[model samples]
Target: MTSLPADDIASPTSTWDLVPATVLSTTETDGPDRPEPRPACEDVRPVIAGHRLIGACADGPRAAQLMFVSDAEGRLARAAEDGSVEPGCTLEELAGDLARSTGRQLHPENPGLRRVLLVRLDAPELPLLAALSGTGFTAVSRHGWSVVVFDGELDYWAVRTGLDETAVVLSSDGATRSFEVLLAGEDPADVTELDSADAVCVLEWGPPWQPAGGLPAGSGRTPAGQFEQDLVRLCAGGTSELQIESVASVFDLDPAETNRLRNYVGGGSTDLVLESVLQLVGLPVLAAKIAEGRREMADLEDARHYEPTAMGPALLRGMTTEPTGDGLMARYQRAVLRRPELLLALAGTEAALGLGLAGAARRGGSGARVLGTLSAALLADAAAESAYWATVRRARRGSARAVPAGLLRRFFGLPEG
Candidate 1:
């Protein structure tokens, strides 16, 4: 078998900086590998009689199947005669002939495949049509009434019929196949010819497919809330691979959520969460900054004794005690007082502003006002700092002056300056 390219084998590293310690170790151990096989398809047949064909693979140890069904007698006859064989047909013939050849009755001498219908359209519709040929039985092309015939087993028919928008798969065996085209506004009875000697047929259709229960309300906040709850639970200590799985499992969150969370973690947002907790606990600015910074980059052992700065101590004291009342605003004020350095950091970095710290401070109270002032100071400080660095950076260029001594020497014809 051909191997996958080396690049395809690679897994992305975790971007989140604050991954649980357990996850870090486990991720290192697990690395990249192929996934395990899914469950096999069992004996499932197309749902005939409702004007649709749906079935599952019976023999294969695979999760999906192929099906072929046709209502058009002329197309069926052409498929059987030309033997040119369509791209996806596994078996094809008139319904009667197909049954006689296979020693099975598709619909017991009805001469027309009544219940089974396969949708057939031009090649351009292949992508949507191919989606139907997957794991389960579902009604497709509901408005089109059609019939289907098959020489292969029901599972094969189910898989093959799924390719209606494209040609059917033809095997090396004498059996030929063609996807039944579901014509617009064409009555099912008008298309069939009773006298055809060879044909295979089955019929099916039913309740329409419903994707997910329904869209969630208010910008889908329900799902987001659920996701947040899952994260909160996972973070509650005793964290393990199981916790990550639990977070991942809720409502089958798609790949996008996984990538988003990874980015949040990678961009040091999780470190901010930890910092938020410290601020809540009344840590002063210097103390919190040192602690938060250490949390961001320092080894675990050094994290405990981080010292609080004067601003940090004052803010923490002000927010946590006496002059403060209790409520949402109060808590926010305290958080602001305790984390002015966070504001400073935010003001200094455009990246932090995008994260919303600056906006949050503008809306806060007296403590928030302090944070706003600190943010301005930080921004100005950053501008000055950048100017200083720019000057330093250009110092060498300025120092490389066109020395008057060299020109003087040249003019005077002196050997040296």
Candidate 2:
């Protein structure tokens, strides 16, 4: 690879206010023992599949996998032993391809997200560094990915020379591993096959790093799996660990909280759903308060059973109310509750599905048909709130009276308007 001027690489404009390191060794008396560089451990060899290097490694209790793609290689690899050439990829084309696989963790056979990656490229390191840095990666060393996985912390040299990307070790599905690249000082002339893993390539962003365009309006008629994919894509957009984890599994949430949100959503107002999800994932104290409030609401529901007249004042005020397991609300609320992080998107989806199911139930649609229709809707992009409320507007039945949005918001402690 031609050596690019170091100045070509973009650096952080400001220094991070890092936490002070605890000084030990000969610190106070003799200037701290020059910090030692951590050892490198490249314990695994990842398979080079097309343009991406996919592999897994473990260090004690921590484990991670790597899915590294190079744009130049994807487009230029030979087809067979006779060496028929394949079309090379443009920078944007390659970036989009990589993002689709990486964004949803559905490629290379559902590897899920990993803690680290081991990359080898022959091009200028600037572009790849930028992408990883923007995605919250910290370069721990020059020795390669293995050593950093074992130590879980970078040496002074790695920190000083590398971008100030913060590294967070999250719970991963594979072995604990570190990410290191095989570039920096290697010779391009010594490189053998361009398609081979040893061949180096530079990475640059494409016009679309991931899938493009806004989510479509959801309906029973949506193409199979589109809505579910939208939900998964929403999870990928999250920046915090809590946001990421919460979206990973809806079943991980508390049953009571899901139940409460279910009733409110059934009543045709998903206004507070986003705030509730944020609190559940990022602020436990607030979540506890919400839970406590829900408990009080539950108590009121119990009171309604014994003193229906006594609860009239509260009901007239449009408070958030709980519905029974078999109620119209539960039919979709429980389904959407499983993935609360998507509550915003799902609010409209659940409403649309509920409407279809309601008509189906009245028209004597079979259980299988009702459930199958709902299943399809769940996987498609949810409808907008306006769409959901429109359906509520057309409702003339007494049952719809229980779904007043203002009362529901008040009962759930949501702000007015």
Write the residue-wise lDDT of candidate 1 on 252-357 in tens digits: 4457654443333233223243233223322222222332233222333212111223432322222222112333333332343344344345335743443355
How many clashes in each candidate?
55, 23
Per-residue lDDT of candidate 2, residues 16-49 (tens digit): 1101001011112233765432211122221123
Q: Report lDDT per candidate.
A: 0.27, 0.28
Highest-scoring model, lDDT: 2
TM-score between candidate 2 and the true structure = 0.15
- Candidate 2 lDDT: 0.28
Ten-residue stretch with the least lDDT total in model 2:
16-25
Listed in order, each prediction's TM-score against the native is 0.13, 0.15
lDDT, residue 27, model 1: 14
